[model samples]
Target chain A: MYENLPALKKPRVAVFELASCAGCQLQILNLEDELVDVLQLIEFAYFKEAMSNTSEDYDLALIEGAVTRASDEQKLLEIREKAAIVGTIGSCAYPVGIPGLKNSGDVEAASELVYGAKAALFPSVPVKPVDAVIDVDFHVLGCPIEKDEFLHTLTALLIGKKPPIPPYSVCVECRMKENVCAFDRGETCLGAVTRAGCGALCPTYGSRCYGCRGPADDPNEPSLEALLEKRGKTPEQIAADYALYNGYREGTAGRREAPDG
Target chain B: MFDRVIGKSDLTDSLDNLAERYRVVAPVSEGTRYRFAEIDGARDLDEGYIPTALPPTKYLRPPRENLITFAWDDEIQVEPVFDQSDFILFGVRPCDLHAIRLLDEIFDREKDDGHYQARRLGASIIGVECLEPCDEHCFCHAMGTLEAAAGFDLLLTDAGDGYYVRVGTDKGRQLLTELSGAREAVYEDRRRLRKIHARRDQAFEPRLDVEGSQIPALLADSNDSLLWDVLGEKCLSCGACTNACPTCFCFDVLDDLGLDLKSGTRYRTWDSCQLEEFAMVGTGESFRQPRDMRVKHRFNHKGRYLVERYGMPGCVGCGRCGRDCLVGIDPIGVFNQLKGQPVERR
Candidate 1:
């Protein structure tokens, strides 16, 4: 199918990871059926997850994970310099993701809790999204990266078309499914402000959205905060909810004032 | 109108017989809520149900429907897709019947929506009248959608010992004549129907501050009202309200390419104007960028715009939007405020 789509020269594509669980890269591998078609569209210059081959020369770089260390930042800068286009592959690479939760508390203290006695050996910096250090051509956002969105973005890039990313909130998709609102069940959910494009997967399966894909464009955080407050969510509970993927953004985890309206 | 009477017990058997000929969809209980789902028999039907979570309109305009499928090998080939499934929408409320008529008017206008028109042509509507208000959120009485005169093949009203069935068309008359247990309405049955109607009229109270005729005028030229900002502050812009509405038929079309990339299906999914990107152009210039503006537009579209365009009420006062809204934003509160009337909570 890709053979008929524009008939362009195969670009050298590379996949790189920084300080993530390698889930985003695994999503590429999880493209089991589409992977065959994808392999035919581009030449892999460097993808440690799938191939042993590595090269500095690449036309496109898909980087995943947050930059948590000085070394991670250095590697990202090098990739940005060499690659013609750099796109963040997941919420981790785009919004600092779960790794950014360290920003809500003392970085050293959190590292010591996990890597005690070796905390000094693994000195970590405040988690920053890939765009914080380098320019990002585009983003494929989700927790591990929705495989369909990743493929869609890649296909659009190959054809020189702007990737279609849904700007609406997850509630749009949630309502299409006609699922009972998570709030109706006395549960505070982030679906109201979270980005769509995952087909409202979490809420469809009877789980509240934790904002794994980050905030939608022009997210009504204040309105959501007020709604959560009405549902008896404490300030700490609301902060913890947002801290998962949005802690990197200033005031996102701390803003708990009553809606002025 | 061909008037007939069917006993409550006989109605079940009639519905069972009807299901054999068509896919009969009726309201069924789902946990604490109710939804309009396909039923095999009357056993699966919830006779006493409030407005369903989704209206019977879903059967006509599905949430996601494929518009066309495209394939390119040597040459690009495209084929339009239309839903051809013939089904009977049973147990539809009077408000929803009005909503369906509004959709029919919209889709069957100058530029006919082929998909909607196809489904509508094959679909049969069997409406059930509501004697009482479903909930505090319902304002069908005020909106003048509680009593539907046409748009239905058969209209059923609950009588004391039986159901009063009013046949509106040849299809409805044929259904009544073909059915086993239905008799011509006599003087006693007519008297009972009259008594039921008298009781029904008193059961429902007007829930609007202004008359239904004045709504369009009130909403006209009030585009820049501050009330939108006040409502927007509380509104999450989640679009639950619009999605649950019976008449909100906006959609966004997208292509889903096959793995091979040459073949794809161009599908339309239910979209909402409440979303921030609903009015965004290719150049990134959003007409209704602010949530307040988007919020105002939806109310105007429901009250003024559709009435001005279609000569019919856009909102049927089903109250699904109000009940489904995470924040308790309803038309009753907004309309009362616009009319300078004190907001009353039922």
Candidate 2:
């Protein structure tokens, strides 16, 4: 149904990477059934991670990773200039990903931790999501985006239709499958408070959700926190759980207070 | 017109007489709390009780509902599932009735949610006004949802001996006609109804100090307030509030495969926004990264954004969220905190 995508005109699609593991791009390749269809829709103009091509101008640009170095900043701006619709594909591209954990720490300490003796050789600045540099039209969430969502979003964009954004929490899906509640099972889960996109995979597999997707449209945090506390989780434990994926976002750690005597 | 004066002991016979033809659902004691379930006999009805563990909305909009089913490989085929049941939601509280009204505004606006509309159309609401306050947690008075008004088909007010039924629609009138025990209201019955309403009004004291209309403006101005950071710090992002809220109706749709991956049903289930992944897209970018932003987004949506967009506050002041919250993060308390006023906690 999605046939008249603007990408078909120029058909030049570039996938770039900076400081990420390129796992998100691999996820794009993992759209097994629709991979060939996606390939036909766009020309692989510049994908250093997947292919061995380097073209200047592109119709659609899918960037993965955070801007960590001076060279990476220049490259991202260049990519934004060439592509009409820039889609950021992962936590690294949108919110600095796991690497953003260092944002709270000093550059020197981070450098020391990573480079050790070659501390001076590594980039000194903290990493930032791609949108901080250039405008990103769309974002694909998850540590590694789901295959169906990737293909569906690409297809929707190809046909000039806005992709549907899910507005529910992970708990909704968990209950749908009739799975035992994570809290009842003695494991704290971010499912209730986390956005509903990953189809509640972690909870389904007998693991607590780590909030790989992102936040929902409207989240009920107070109740969720209370539920966790009742289940025996400490305040620090709750803060630590949210800090995993959302450390950069100021409220992710919740309210900070001065220590009382 | 004669005053209806059936003995209190004959309440069950009167209800059983009505149940012979129409499907009846009433409040029944389930564990520590009461719950609304189908009643084959009048004994299932809990006349004087607390609010049900879950609202009657479950009977209308189930937790998991089938949206559309698809079959691929050769030709993409799809079938949309629509609600096709005719049932009665008996003994709904006024707050829940108000909740249904709020839901009607959402599901019936613009595109029209066929699933919700279908279920709503076939169902009838029989409201029972609370003789006494449900509990310390209930704040329906502050939200102005304590009295049954326009949403229900019928409203039943308990008089000394029998119920003074106010028929709100033709269906309600027809249903009441089926109950042979019911008679036309006399002067005394009308006077008693007024007394019951007045007593109920005086009984439910305003629990929260904030004005309902000003909540939107308060939230809009407090967007960047440090309270979010403070609230965020304590928040575990567990999502109990959203789940407990009668008005929080956001959902997620997914395809489930049963052994043979080809044949699966696409079902839509209730989803909360408090979790970290609610706003995450396929590419891994999270729109609301911090717990603070996520928590704030929720309050704003319920208190301000939805009202701005749909002209209605998302909260019905049921107090389920407050009762269920572990850290005592009540919405009223949060609102009061935003206004820089001392909170009146139950």
Off by over 4 Å in 1: A1-8, A250-261, B221-224, B341-346
Q: How well does each candidate reproduce the native contacts, as fnat? A: 0.62, 0.16
Per-residue accuracy of model 2 over B216-265 as CA lDDT, tens digit each: 88888888788887777666555667766677788878665422224557
lDDT of 1 by residue, B112-191 (tens): 99999988878878889999888999998888898897879999998867889998778788778655688888888888
lDDT on C-alpha atoms for all candidate structures: 0.83, 0.71
In angstroms, give how far residue B157 of model 2 lies from its true place. Answer: 1.1
Identify the leading candidate in terms of DockQ: 1
Per-prediction TM-score? 0.93, 0.59
Interface RMSD of each: 1.5, 8.2
Looking at model 1, give its docking quality level: medium
Candidate 2 segments whose C-alpha is farther than 4 A from its true place: A1-261, B1-11, B17-23, B72-74, B341-346
